[model samples]
Target: MISLHWLILSPLIIGTTAKLMPIKAAKKIMVLFQTALLAAVTMIFVEVRQNGPLLENIGSWPDTIGITLRADLLATAMVFLSCFLFLAMVIFVHNKNYADHLFFFLFLGLESLIIGIFLSNDVFNIFVLIEAATLIITILIMYKQASVSVYDGMMYFLINVVAMSFFLMGLGMLYKKIGVLDFYALEAALSQVNNPASLILPYAFMITAISLKAALMPLFSWLPKAHGTPSAPSVVSAILSGLYVKTGIYVFLRLQTTFAPLIDTSELFVILGFITAVVGFMLALAQTDIKLLLAYSTVSQIGVIMIGISLNNPAAYWGGLYHLMNHAIFKSTLFLTAGMIISEYKTRKISEIHGVYSHMPAVGVATILSILGIIGAPLFNGSISKFLIATGASGSWIESGLILINLGTIIVFMKYGQLLFGHSDKKEAANSDILEKAVVLTLSMLCFLGGIFGSDLIAILFNISLTINPLSYGEKMLLFVGSILLGLLIYRSLFKKRNPLAFIRSFELGFNEICLSITLFFAFMVVYLKITL
Candidate 1:
C-alpha cells in the first residue's frame, strides 16, 4: 500500500513541478500525474478494505506528540473519492477554455488539502487544512477576475473566515481541557472526565462552524453565490458541488464520533436537516437561472444526507453515507453537463434553453440519467439510499417528512428538466470535446451502476452486507412512483402559473444575517445540551 503521507503530498509535488514546465508539456505531465495518483489511491483503498486501517505517527515521535495520519475506512474512502473526482475534473477541463497550468496547480493543491483534512488525526491540523482550502477556493472562484466574480469570491472567503474562527475557538477549548489535539488521544482523555457538560460549549462552537461548512440552513447563503458564479468554470463548479462541500459533512461526522461519549445532538441535526431540505428546495423551485437552481438543489441534498446520518438508526446512517457518495457522482454529472448546456445555448435561464436532446444527444442522455439518480427513481443510486433511509423512518411522522422531501426534490428537478426537450434546427457538431463528454457520461453511468450494486457497494465500503427485502423494495417502488406523479401535478398547478415560488427566488441571507444565525444556532445547541445533560 502507498504511504498516507505520499497520498497527501504527491498531488502538491506534481502541481509545483508542472508549473516549472512548458504549458504544453505541463498538460501532458498533469495527465500522467493524475493517472498515477488515482492508481495509488485505488491501491490504498483496496488495501484498507482487505486489511484494516493503516495508522502512522509522523516525525518518528510518540503517538501522543506526533502528527498521526490515519487511513481508516472513512478516511481512505474519502481520499479515494476525492482522488477520483479530481481526476475527472482535470479530464473535464482538458482542451476546455479554463485548462491552464495555474488552474491545475490550484486544483491539485486543493486536492492535497482535502486529503490532509481526511487523513488528519489532530483537530488543529484539520483547522489549518480547512483554512488553506478556503483560500485556494477563494482564488478559484475569483479565477475569472471579473468584477462580480471577485465579489463572490470575497464573500465566500469572508464568510468562511468567520466560521473557521468558531472552529479554532472550539479546538482551543478542547486542547486546554484535555491537553490533546489528536482524536484518539482526546477521546481517551475525555473518557476520564466525570461530567460531559464541560464539552457542551466546545461542541456547540465546533458544530456551528461545521454546520456552516456543510451549508446547513442559515449558513447556506454562500453556496449558491460560489457554486453559481457566472464566470466560474464547469470543472470548478463540479468540484465545489460534488467534492468540497462533502468535506464539511465528513468533518461533521468525525466530530460527532469524537464527542459520542459526551453528546447526542442527532435530534437537533435531524430537525435542522428537515428544515434545510424544505427551504433549500423551495428556493431551488423559485430560481430561473439554471446554475443557481442546481446550487440550491445541492443545499437540499445536503439536508437529506444529514437526516440519514442523524436518524439514530443503522439503516439510515449507512444510507446517508452511501447517499453522500451517490451525490458526488450524480451531482457532478449534472454540473458538468449544465456547463456544457449553458455554453451551447448561450444562456443560463431555464426558460431560454431548449432542444437539448436535438442539439446534443449525448449530453441530453447524461442529464436524464443524472436527474433520475438525484430524484430517487427506482433502479438508481438515490433510490437505494433513500429506500434505506425510509426503511429506518418507517411507521413514524418522520417517514412522511422523508416522503415530502423526496417529492420536493422531484418537483425542483421537474422544473430544471425543461432543458431536455423542444425544437432546434442547429446541428449537433462542436458539442464540447470528446474527453469532457466522456467524463460526464462516465459519472452518469456510475449513477446507474451504483444502484444495481448498491448492497455490494455498501459491503465493500462499510465492511457490512445488507440485503434489500424484495417485498419492501416493491413498496418503495410504489412510493417512488406516487411521489413522481404528485410532484408533477404540483409542479403544473402551482409552479407553471404566474409562478407561485417566484418571489422566494429573491430571498437571500446577507452576511450579517448569516453571522447572527450562527450565534443563535450555537446558543441553541449549548442550551439544549445544558438542559438535557
Candidate 2:
C-alpha cells in the first residue's frame, strides 16, 4: 500500500528537492534518489508478484467516486522496467556534464508521470499523467536549446496537446455514459450498457489520440525529429525509444481491453501494424543519419509488437510482451552506443563512420549484440520472441508479413552494420568512460541471456508455458541466414548506389497535415467498427 504511494510521489519529492539544492549537491541527491526509487520499485514488484496486485483508493473513497491506484502484473512489470531503464540511464550519463539540476528534475518528473500512467486505474488519471509526461519530455528534448530542436519540441508539444484534447473529450463522453472512470468499473458498466454503439464515438476519439501517441502509420512524422534530433541528449533518445513510446502501447492495450465489450478493433490494429512495420523499415533503410536510422527501427519494432499482441493468440501476446522488454534492452543500447559513436566520430552519417570494432571494442561489441537481437538472429532475445510470435501466426498472411518485415529489418541493420568494419581516413580518439561501457555491455549481455533462457524467462515473468522444438531450430537458422544474404544483396545492388528514395527522406508533413491524418484515422476506425458491427 505504501509502495504505491512511494512509486507515485517519491520521484516528485526528489525532483522538488533537487530544485532547492545547489547544482553539484543536487546531482548527488538525484543519483541517490533514483537509486533508492529503483530499490523501492523492485521490492514492490516482488510484493506484487507474491500478493497479486496492490490496490489503493485515494482518501479512502468508494470505487465509484475515488481515484484508484492498482499495481497488477502488467503495471508492476512496466514500473519495474521503467525504474531499471531510468537507473541505467542515470548511470550512463553520470560521468558527463549533462547532469544539470533542471535536467535531473525534469527527467525525474517524467519518470514519475510515466509510473503514474502505468499504475493509475482511473482513466482520467491516466490522461492527466500522459499530458504531464508530454510536457516534461518536450522540455527534455529541447534541453540543449538548439533552433531545430526547439521547433521539434514545439511540434511534439502541440501535436500531443491536440491528441490529449481528443482524449479529454472522450473521457468526458465516457464519464457521461458510465458515470465512472475506474477501469474495472467502467468495463463493468460498459458490459451492462444497452447501446454499446453509442460508445463508439468516444472510443474512436480516445483511440485516435492513442494511435498518434504510439506513432502509428501516417501519425509518426514527429517521432524521428524528436527522437533523432542531434541536439537532444542520448539518454533522452533512449528514454523515448525504450520507455515513453511503450506507455502509449500500454495504454492502447489497457483501453482496448477495457472497452472490449463495446468494440474489438484488434483486426484494425493488426493491419495498421503491418503497414507501420513496412513503412518504418522502408524509411529506416533510406536514412543516412545513424540516429534517425535507429529511431525508425524503433517504429518498426513497435509495429511488430503491436501485431503480436493484436493477433489474439496467447503465445503471440506473451511474445509481444517479451519483445517489448527485449526491445527496451537492445534499442536503448543501440541509441546510447550511437550517441557515443557520434561523439567520438563527430559525425551522424553511417557512411562516414567505420572501423568501430577497431576503434572502441566495447561499444562495437555492444552494437553487434544489439544488432543481432534487432534482426532476430539466433541465440538473441529477438529470435525467441519472433519465433513465438511466428508460431502463433501459423502460416497465415500475418506470418508472411512478419517475415517480410524481418527481411526489411535485416536490410536496414545491414546498412547500419557498415560502421563495424573497414577503415576510415578520419582519426579520432575513441574513449568512453567505464560507467557508459558497463551500462551498454550489461544491456547487451541481457539480450544474449534473454534468448538463451527465453522459455524459462517467459514462464517466470508472465507465467506462460511454451515449448521450443529443437527440430525446428535448423529451419529457423536457415531462414535467418537466407534473409541476411538477401538483405546484403539488395543493399549492395540498390542502396550501394545513391539512395533513389531520397524524396521520401526529404518529405515533411506540416501540423495541419498531421492533424488531418489523425482525423482520417479516427473516421476510418469509426466507419470500420460500424460496418463490422
Best by lDDT: 1
What's the distance in Å from true for residue 532, model 2? 1.0
Residue 128 in model 2: lDDT: 90
Candidate 1 positional error at 24, Å: 2.4
Q: On residues 339-446, what C-alpha lDDT tens digit does candidate 2 reach at each position? A: 999988989999899899888999999999999998999999999999888877877899889989999999899889999898856576577899999999999999
Provide backbone clash counts, one per model: 0, 0
List residue ranges in candidate 2 displaced over 4 A. Answer: 426-428
After superposition, the stretches of candidate 1 with alpha carbons farther than 4 Å from their true spots are 425-430
Identify the leading candidate in terms of TM-score.
1
Cα lDDT tens digits, model 1, 1-533, are: 67789988899988898888987788878877888888998888888889898898888899878889999898888888998898888777778666678888899999999999999988999999999999999999999898888999999999999999999999899888888889888777777888999998888899999999999997899999999999888888899999999999999998888888878889888989999999999899989999899999999999999999999999999999999999999999999999998888888998888888778888998999999999999889999999998888888777999899999999999998888898764665646789888998999999999999999998988887778998999998998899998998998999865578888866677888878888888888889999999
Q: How far is 365's C-alpha from truth in model 2 (Å)?
A: 0.8
- TM-score of every candidate relative to the true structure: 0.98, 0.97
